[model samples]
Target: MTVAKTINRKLVKTITQRSLSTIAPQVRIYEVGPRDGLQNESKFVPTDIKIELINKIAAAGIKDIESASFVSPKWVKQMSDGVDVMKNLPRAPGVNYPVLVPNLKGYDTARQCNVEEVAIFPAGSEGFSQKNLNCSVEEGLKRFKLVADQAVKDGLRVRGYVSCVVGCPYDGPIHPKGIAKITEQLFEMGCYEVSLGDTIGVGTAGSVQRLMREVLTVAKPEQLALHFHDTYGQALSNLLAGLEYGIKTVDSSISGLGGCPYARGASGNLATEDLVYFLYGLGVNTHIDLVKLMEAGRYISNYLGKPTESKVNRALGDRFKNHNDIAKMASCDV
Candidate 1:
């Protein structure tokens, strides 16, 4: 059956108005630096630094920040202190902190902390599903469904993630059909929004356009978000393709701090600095202070003992060295 026949009627509005050449005047950048960016680190980032990193990012005015992930500490060592991170986090007004909940147990733990939102990640390819969650795609979705159900009943928002939307490191090529099916299921399971991820950073503009065609069939642009990895240097190009589909919410990390475990360090998501710089140039309103954002980026990068992977961050590196030199950084970046 076509998507119109299979998906919810409320979501099946006019398809003719689905594409756009220019981005929306207002865009929402979902900040994932504190959780996804720090998940695979060889050393555990102190809870102090994690809270500080998240607070600093919030201070820069990002609305939706993915602050922590409630996964097995055995698998993701850096996120072991998820509880402490949540407890110690200074509640910021107008800022929503969403955490990743991979299972029902994780979701239960997170709910006790009074989290307003939770995200569930399911893979597009079978190979990745097995490696990442040790289950088939179908089984993983079933697991996330339980979490989504409870989250809704608890009066919390549920966000879904479909990883490896273009291609997977282990699974190779992914057909748009699979992504559409998964996206539909997430929506059916009560996900308010689903962010499609190119986990290994292998997606190109052509691939994104093709994949989004199928995705938009099952999902409204407003109900979807884009998350691209920059490993192949095609993140901006791929983002443009998603923008054409009228997807205004995008996932990004501070200073490009996260990377796929398969790849080297800190190369996964699009750098928030680069994304903001692009949007600002386009006259898109993100309501984020570019100068303060770089300061936050520099904070985490400095503590991580690695240089920032953001091109925008590097171009203005000199200014960040002197935190109070906001004037210098602004002159250099904007």
Candidate 2:
């Protein structure tokens, strides 16, 4: 009788856990550290390290990784070796390595590398569109539409990014309607998915909820992804608000790398370690190997000669370090 009762309790616990996880389903983490995270480095990261860093992120179980950008060296000196990085990457099976292309020229250059997918970045704020692309938003979208059309004909998937969803440095406090309009156009432009970026990270949960309600009106939750920077410490909260509305995809960087070059006060993206830890706690399935992910974060942070910006990585790093120290001590003569 006692054994039967214990088995019955265990079965009930497993069923309850499964039910809890069904609230949001699986969360797909698109790792953007190699491209967005490292783009701002004043020092050029050697192509070798970039390749290894990307592979490490992939080994950590990230299905999608932004490998490089095909912009000119005059603009982003760090990504000057974009072609070599793409050509030499040991393109793993079952993983998507998408590169960012600024215009038809960049997209055509990326085509030579036989990339599987290409991502187009067009900011929602007119100020950013002029500053970043040196044109109005309408003109910029027209250019990207040509690129998207060509990419489709070439048999490559196109991903869209709408930056400055919540606020902008030059424009400031962008209305949700503008964001939705851009999202709607991108969806109609042959982009299988679009990632909305809170580039300056000034968004609150209330702001995120408001944006969610507006953006969802034009695009379904599954067709969109959230990219939030941690400048104001609200990235996690803003994500939670979006999650409440059933969005399951997020873009995060390892060790919290990346800052807006165009926006002065903005910061790095929300740390991958932080996001995965948060989701795991809520019983949401991320399918990421946290230990491997942390190792990858530590590798890049060490290479960059800086402490990591991830709070979760800092916490677990010490624990793992102490554990390793104890293991070493025990191996020595008692």
TM-score of 2: 0.89
lDDT of each: 0.86, 0.89
RMSD of each: 8.9, 6.8
Worst 10 residues of 2 by lDDT: 321-330
Structure candidate 1, residue pairs in collision: none
TM-scores of all models?
A: 0.89, 0.89
Candidate 2's residue-wise lDDT over 83-159, tens digit each? 99999999888999999998999998999998989999999899999998899999989999999999999999999
Model 1's number of clashes is 0
lDDT per residue for candidate 1 within 57-146, as digits (tens), equals 988889999999999988898998999999889999899999999999999889878899999999999988998899999999999999
Model 1 TM-score, 2 decimals: 0.89
Q: Model 1 segments beyond 4 Å from truth?
A: 1-22, 262-266, 318-334
